[model samples]
Target chain A: MKSEVNTVNNNISSLAQAKPLASPAVQIDFLNSDDLIKFETKLESSALYPLVSSDIDIFQVNLGKMCNQVCKHCHVDAGPDRKEIMTKETMQLCLDALDSCNISTVDLTGGAPEMNPNFRWFIEELSQRGKHIIVRCNLTIILANNKYHDLPDFFAKHKVEVVSSLPHFSAKRTDSQRGKGVFEKSIEALQMLNAIGYGKADSELRLNLVYNPSGAFLPDDQKGLENEFKRRLKNNFDIDFNELFAITNLPISRFLEYLVDTEKYEDYMQELIDAYNPEAAKGVMCRNTISIGWDGFLYDCDFNQMLDLKVNTASQHIRDFNAEDLHSREIIVNQHCFGCTAGSGSSCGGTTT
Target chain B: MDNSYYDPKDLKKFGNITEWQPKLGEKFFDYYGEVFKEGALTAREKSLIALAVSHAVHCPYCIDAYTSDSLKKGADEEQMMEAIHVAAAIKSGAVLVHGVQMMNKADDITM
Candidate 1:
């Protein structure tokens, strides 16, 4: 009877908090539900439900680390500050790896991968081979250069799966992480992509949003957050996308700096360790997705690539790219593994679960 | 917005969580060491859960670490394998338990 009274009180308080009656656009803040089940209920019903995915087979190429913005959590130290760019010969090495590996997909990434002069040429080659092409875009880069002006239509034409970053739906949060005015430019770039049918729900040209956490903490539940993101973004910015990928920020480079600066190094480490749900150990991205750096060196994943932790095999570079060699190759990992095991695991592709 | 407490994206400043909090960092280091020992749930098992938790609680650091850990622990095969099955079971179970609320709602309607 006492419990029942408590439940009644909760219901009454909730009712009182329910829609201000003045605002129809929102019933309540989407993820404020103390009830996890309510959140999941919304997730299963979301339009951007992570399509059960296995890696699209392919040797992905890290074109370069020449980005336009300096995101706080970037493990690559990628920014206008980074000068490393992929060479044409290195690009050719990628093609060679693709040919040797018979990879069906060819993922292209970088600081602002579009900044690579050969970016278009490489995509054109991949498209010619009828490979599923994936391009990681910073989004703002599209507007940063005239040469990139038609990236949306170009991506659509080639049917490239464009995974672009938009850290948060709100301008304030986004700008804080990615630099001033970047949010506006990202939105514009997204609109351009949408106009070309890149992110339309049913369109073949896929445009997915990439989310990195602004601070040291892990991202929220992807399904619930994605639903809220879809709703808020669709309603607020007139933007449309197929999915929102919640990627983890690895502890390396600038982020490592953040850890030290914030003195969150220990707690964050403990969080991952304490939250080390053994379940995440099985399906991490690096297990299936092999990362190739700009110079054709093979690493288990992009973070490994940055740490210069090349795959432990006789054949390291793309020129020596071999599926048989990689078949049982031990992926190199260290203390950072806690990050992935700590939460719903994160990876280059996004959240593991 | 980025700390352990609360992040009101609804509010502009997620609050100034001073640049450093040494205590949490120390705590993390100690637990991290404990979690990594052999048979301490093995980093591999933790990886799969970390991935799922990445989706659950949403920490990017945990996600990155586990993704790498899972792969390193001879988890090179497609994650769609048995390990993924485990995560699927847990994640689905987690979501489904909340269905009790929906059932309660239905029960309320009936009564």
Candidate 2:
């Protein structure tokens, strides 16, 4: 026999002759093929969980969908070019919801939200009503144009809790998920908010930064990632804030388009289904928060609002807001729900945990 | 597609990424690394949190990374499955809770 070298060489040659099993890009179809039936079953059966809820009062103010940027993951399909802006009538209805219901917290969201012509006015009205207001701002929007140049002062003035999207502290990754130049402006805007004492530990201004992944991945750890975001922004760009919220991007609108375009749909969905955490399930945001569509239609969250899944209640639009009637109403759900409960749970605010 | 982001077509010019800014890419790389490491929380803990958040934000890349991460870091199949269920609960709950507004709207209509 020859030597051990000859034997090893023969084995290596045979190994090279074999075909590859699958590439990482689309491995699900190749290896996880057997999961198709179970995947479909789970997808259809998301709401069978034990954590259903029916008590909530706040009427989240979805003022409009016209945002300054068309983020790749935006569910509302809102952007600067959008002509559909919230009307004064819708604003009034939101205020009415605050006044009529025992709703104490009013979550205000929109495209850039600050880009809304009546955004400040709406905040003023809600503040006047002594409601806990949360304005979801795309940080970059605060500094992108002169019209919104004064947003920091405006938010702080109303004592509004600002939930701004940062995605990442680094520019390239952030810009990759958002558009070009967005990361820099976001950092700058965050700095402005920090200067105004929004995210500071003891500050009451309450500037919470939101982070979604740059690609089709889960957001990294929230507390640690927040510390890092705080450290980096503080070191690199001199920005500061209170908390760093790590949010999972909902698979709808532009993000759904991205998944289909990049061919990451099935694997990603399977990953979510495979990684469902029961602890995460208990903290799901939909149970506590209400999302209103731009047109006053109701949705469980912004993602469903984008998919046009209005509440399945007798009153679906803003023209009919009654806290008690909704207290016992059953929520309508579909496959997209798996996206929410798949992991730690996601919401407009961030991780439910 | 013609944006300034790292397009794969431009993978060959990895050296040129820093031409625009000398240390930005590597800096991002470092921060990116630090973010994914074990924390006061273990890697397993971090992975589970990431997995849960992936559903909340709904990033497929995140779902892919955290699924593998959780499994590798000792998350059993059931544990992982349970995490997604948590997300489902919150998501559906979020959708259903808004029914309050609808109920209020309906109450105003009927009552």
Candidate 3:
């Protein structure tokens, strides 16, 4: 009964309009491949067989995939529509492991960690246990909803170390990587955090910003980029942060799709492979960190966690936590490990050397 | 053995310029290296300038090299695009400004 000519336009929400940007171009097995393994062998000493862990000092927990913004380069493919979340039971199990496993830092991450319903409860428990809590916050989340408006105050109260991702100090670059209006919200959120003494001199309320390259390349000198970010942010927005962490974009999920879409997958992979630094490889974060997914599965690193490459061990869940076994287990690796080992190396904490 | 004027493989043999005139080629490379080093302008700024000039000169090899170099030097997409626009505007203006010569010639020859 409608007219042939259109009148008022009906459109879907951005979230509804969202679909994955990257898809596998060819049928290729990223894992169990001979090329990456051969490359690793050439880079390693005679003792390199199964890449093993040293000790689990940093326990990173992915709360869920629910996020306010769907970034083009997200490895997790996490968005608002993702209903996966860690249950309180799993959180309790993780807390129990932390108590026994001598874990020093509890690194909490997610599509947006704050979006988790039990985020506060888990943080409170970790804080009470005297664990150094690092919340991998996406700054826009602080300004996403009215309830989240008080996040800065809450973070300050808990003395949580907030590591937020700000792809660039410039609005144009940041918005292109994230979404429209995201850069403004992130700036507002940063200002709020600064007002609460989060990034102040002689303040324990530490606030660090994260930077990842916005394209198919490795990040430049971390210290130089950090200085540029600090100078620009101070001059333009009157903002300050403890430090900037420049992360390399891993070749997985949306980024992999981007590589395939642009026909640069092999070239980019070759670049990473060619730039492999043995010194950087020795300090890869997987040696000391263990990542736990929302559904209780474990991984050597977050990238492995996203790729469903669970920790290479029998006891691969928090419920089956065996400190000795988990600590001694070999790390699960693929070609993507090159991302972390290239140049000065990358991890949740930024450059290795 | 191909008869094509522009061989795709010629781009790969860019380093072989020294084969013909080693001394001059080496000097040109050394001067080129010195010019691109960080000075009053940061490496990033120099890279953007090079990218713009590459577009103006319309050199495919230079364009490709400078595009990657500019990105590695921390130039984002918007900055790169803006640099290209700068090149485009200058190129367009250069051609238009030369049109004044045509106008003068036409007036002087007219009866």
What order do candidates take by DockQ, descending?
Answer: 3, 2, 1
Q: Which candidate would rank higher by lDDT, 2 or 3? A: 3
lDDT, model 1: 0.67
Candidate 2 lDDT, A1-353, residue by residue in tens: 11232222221211132313112212223324444434335533554443344667445767776766766666666665565677888888877776777878888887767767887888888888888888888887777778888888988888989998877665665666577798878877877888878888788899888877765666545676676677777887777788777777665655655665577767667666666655566566676667787778877667667666677678887779777766655555544555666666666666776
- Candidate 1 residues lying further than 4 Å off, grouped into runs, are A1-58, B1-111
lDDT of 3 by residue, A1-353 (tens): 22221111112112244434322222125423334445457446535546778988899999998888778778877777778899999999999888777888999999899998999999999999988999999999998889999999998888999999999987877876777788999999999999989888778999999999877888887877787788889998999999999899988876776676577677788778777877778888999998999999898988888777898898889988877888768777667788888889999999997
* DockQ for all candidate structures vs. native: 0.02, 0.02, 0.39
The top-ranked prediction according to TM-score is 3
Alpha carbon lDDT at A115, candidate 1: 88
- Predicted complex 3: CAPRI docking category: acceptable
- Candidates 2 and 3 compared by DockQ, better number: 3
Q: Over the true interface residues, superposed, what is the Cα RMSD of model 1?
A: 13.2
TM-scores of the candidates in the order shown: 0.65, 0.68, 0.83
Cα displacement (Å) at residue B56, model 2: 36
lDDT of 1 at A255: 63
Report the lDDT of model 3 for residue A210.
92
Per-residue C-alpha lDDT of model 1 across residues A44-143, encoded as one tens digit per residue: 3433122122343546678888777767666666766456799988888777767776668777888778888888888998898889999989999889
Interface CA root-mean-square deviation for model 3: 1.9
Order by TM-score, highest first: 3, 2, 1
Worst 10 residues of 3 chain B by lDDT: B4-13
